[model samples]
Target: MNKLLIFDLDDTIFETKSIKKESVKPIFDQLEPLLINKFGTALTAQIIPELWKYPFDFVAEKYKFDKHQNTEFARFINEHEYKLNIRTFDDFSVVENLKQEKILVTTGFSKLQHAKIHYLGIKQKFSEVYIDNILSSERVFKKGIFQSILLERKIEPQLVYIIGDNPNSELKAGFELGLHTVQVAKFGQEKSDYANYCISNFNELIPILK
Candidate 1:
């Protein structure tokens, strides 16, 4: 039996679908000044998501903003509004009821991710949480974070399962460690490499975990 079940935070465990959109609108106003002042005008908020995928300094260079401005921007974004959407997809409850020790292994700033977990009401469900801070400054994430978890807990790779949306990083890293990998694909997602199984809802994992 799998002793540990690892999960990705965004788009996997907690999604924005069930949240009230109106509650999150003020977040745009909160960060608009940083964007406007550094870049001379606010780019569409849509770019914020893409901006996070790369280092702020590199993004600043790409946009012709002063190099240090990106650090300020990243700091502001990292600190604000993570509590806006405290809702999760319906199937997330399946994870809560599981017998195995559930661990969150996501890549991002811990402050923001932790706030999301707290507000989303799943923080208590996880026995452990590991955030890959390397993602904040790098795009290609290959660092073996699970190496520490395995050694510390003495959990064998074959007895663990990693579930996430990203095929390249999350699934690939777990697969390389010889752990079972599951890609929690979004609707219309293409095939995910390195996944032992791919499913759209956490409900599907109920039987798999059994």
Candidate 2:
């Protein structure tokens, strides 16, 4: 059977912490003063973390920010402010080599994720892009999103392979779907059960994929 490879966007493909520390972090820094000015310093600190957890729309709703402000903030973080520090590992090329059959699966804001993909110039590498809808956050859980992908793509379970860093959700999704699972922990993060195979970096993936 022909193989299908699926990948997670953040951390799995590109390093997200670098972007968070560089681009998004500054927005939070800028917001701190504004938040403190309006909501008081203590309240600002208390709410900031929670705001980070919520999606921009949810944050906007909970905080009652105007649509213009929300749009502006999103534009600032996604378009102008954020920087893509994407480093394609040896394994990345291995996967990209399979572009004819691979798909990029990401769960998050469509605009933001697409912006990053465009910024990195990796849009051509993916046969299909699966993004989470703003209405439902089911994509955050790998199993739910993977099932949707399987249904939409009409892929057989045995022909699919999911490669990612944190194996928790991805592995679970793959296991449930009976797809092969490959865990790449190049960043050294600890992973849970469900990883059929574990490799430390992308270099290792080349051989495995072969």
Candidate 3:
């Protein structure tokens, strides 16, 4: 049977933490003073985590910032959104190599994922892109959405494999649905259960794919 490869976007394809730390955090820092001016002392603590939740819209709604401010924030974020310092584990080659044999699966917000994919210029590498908006619901634990992709696409369970960093949810979903699973460790994360195979680096995956 033909094979399918599903990848997680954040830590899998791109270093999500790094982008948040370098790019997004700075914008939040700039917004801190603005938030303080708008909301006062309550701004500091609330703004910190709030910037992360929905990041853009959350700030906009909380401050009642006009469209200009919103557009400026989006522009600032989009400009520095991706640093591209780290290479994709498979690099460009992985997607190209897989194109010969399998499909690729991923789930995220459409705009956010699309920006990164376009910046990386690997949008065409995937046979399918399953953004969260396309799914039936908006929840983060997206196992059901993953399952829907398989059923909707008419792909076989055995032919599908999920590759990601956090194995708990994705691995559980894949295993429960009868697909193969591979876990790639995040920078500071220790090994965890749920993955059928775990590796620290993407290069380690080549042999397992065989």
TM-score of every candidate relative to the true structure:
0.75, 0.70, 0.65
Clashing pairs in 1: none
Cα lDDT tens digits for candidate 2, 32-90: 67667666888778778876655555566677765555555655555554456666554
Sorted by lDDT (best first), the order is: 1, 2, 3
> What is the Å distance of residue 35 in model 1 from its true position?
6.0
Look at candidate 3 and tell me the lDDT of residue 113: 61
Q: Candidate 3 residues 3-32, lDDT tens each?
A: 677877767776655443664466666666
C-alpha RMSD between model 2 and the true structure: 4.8
lDDT of each: 0.70, 0.69, 0.63
Put the candidates in TM-score order, highest first. Answer: 1, 2, 3
Best by TM-score: 1
Query: Whose lDDT is higher: candidate 1's or candidate 3's?
Result: 1
* Candidate 3 Cα outliers beyond 4 Å, as residue runs: 20-43, 46-92, 99-108, 133-141, 186-188
lDDT of 1 at 47: 50
